[model samples]
Target: MGLGLRWYHFALWAGFILVMALMPEFVSKGTLRTMIFANFLAIFAISWDVLSGRTGYISFGHPFLIGIGAYTTAILTKRFDVPVEYAIPAAIAMTMVGGTIMFLPALRIKGSYFALVSLAFMELIYQLVQVIRPDLTGGTRGMSGIVTLTRGAANGYYLSFSLMIIVALSMWLLMRTRLGTALSAIAMNEESVKGSGLSPTKLKLFAFMTSAFVAGLGGAFYVHYLGSIAPRALFDINFVFTIIVATLIGGASTIVGPMFGAFFLTFLLEYLRPFLPGAERYLIYGAIALLLYMYQPKGLYHIFMSQLDRFKKSGDDD
Candidate 1:
């Protein structure tokens, strides 16, 4: 399918970019830092959605995949003396390879079995990095002095935000194409998609590869930006929960939803910091998430559309 870009899409994205570019003038450095995390989270959430969200495969092992990208680039740059340009792409390639290995199990298994296998993959990585090559992997302490792409929070914010926009815009446009329609159709009914003569295996593999590409790109850049990597933190279940909750709360199977969810969740945590400055905050946070999921399982994006449609119908009636 052609671009099918509309005037409203241009207007909306332009307005968003303009506001984000101007945000440094209004928000505190702390908020900027928070937004930076949100940007990365959006990238990760988008990665999750393209495969698991859109294709009916729930992957609980994203951090495992992301960690591969992060660790790969970090090792190449730190241990092998590779340039940033080459290191990043190499890391992405490794991630795709890792993703292919990850996808092999998916061909045979699905549903919770698929999710459990994915989780096991991540846990296996966590243990392997520490034991296999502690020198390169940095083991329990992890690696440092890695090259950083940006210096300050301001610069970091700009870099991350720009990357987020690029990935979001590209993925959104891609999903608007006929290939996107086929992928979503698989999610709805794989049997029907096969009947239509589309190979579900190929489509799923493509989706996994795309997701791996994103995870690799985002993970590689994130490590360089942070100038470090730690296995325990990267492979943690809490991190996976954050990603899944962000995607679910934002709206699964939609690019824009995850972007919004990341910001909203990040800001919500920020606001709660003063009242609950410790891990206890997650109790309240998780409660809110549960309530929202219970009420509107489709997430905030669906709610927005519902309201917009109601407004339109009201105007028509009037």
Candidate 2:
């Protein structure tokens, strides 16, 4: 069954909004800067969870779709002299089309085959971008001095958080509808869903498109926020791992899990930065992530849920 929002959900969100609104009052700029990364990570993770996490169709090439959005916007605004407003929407449309192309294979295959193909797609995009047009793509160095959405960390934090909140709530609410149930049903048993007279292909396409939309939105804004875009950074495997790990460690198939997971993973990285600076940091971060994954594969959200269940049971017994 699809998850339903409860009264507590409203209260929880309201409290979250209040806290976010007040965050700058107490935290240092450095922390807020870290938070801005977390917010963007959350967005990327949510984009990931929408298709791969929920539908059980793991997309190793999610960064591919995101790259489409980021590159489209970057190229449009930088080389073509297009305005930011138009570039962003154009990026979204491009991603949707890219997603459809990616989704086509799903109609025929899945699992390892699909995963490998998606990885190839990402590599294909990465190679093509650098070689296709050195003049526009800036060759190996990547394009810099792009337009920025916000000036300082504080404004950036607010902007990112607002988008995060909107995406989280919107996706969460959408998943509560019947469409969510159908998508999950497809994930669980596509054959069964088909037998039930539902069109699995159509449902899967919708999920793909939805994931693309979020990826595009996040990527377009993320590039603008950073004021730069690069093929190597956008298509890197580490970026893919981070998104997958955040979603898995946050509790896949749950909207809140990815968001929470993104922040948790980001802070973990920040905390370990001192002890393990530079590329060495991922070693400790990877180890901690593996331990957490082993300890609670269902993620922090599942742990909280199990504890909550036990508490309720104990109260009833009492």
TM-score per prediction, in order, is: 0.96, 0.96
Show the colliding residue pairs in model 1: none
**Candidate 1: Cα lDDT at 34:** 94
Q: Native-vs-model 1 lDDT?
A: 0.91
lDDT of each: 0.91, 0.90
Q: Which regions of candidate 2 deviate over 4 angstroms?
A: 1-3, 314-318
Steric collisions counted per model: 0, 0
Where does candidate 2 have its weakest 10-residue lDDT segment? 1-10
**RMSD versus native structure for model 2:** 1.7
TM-score of 1: 0.96
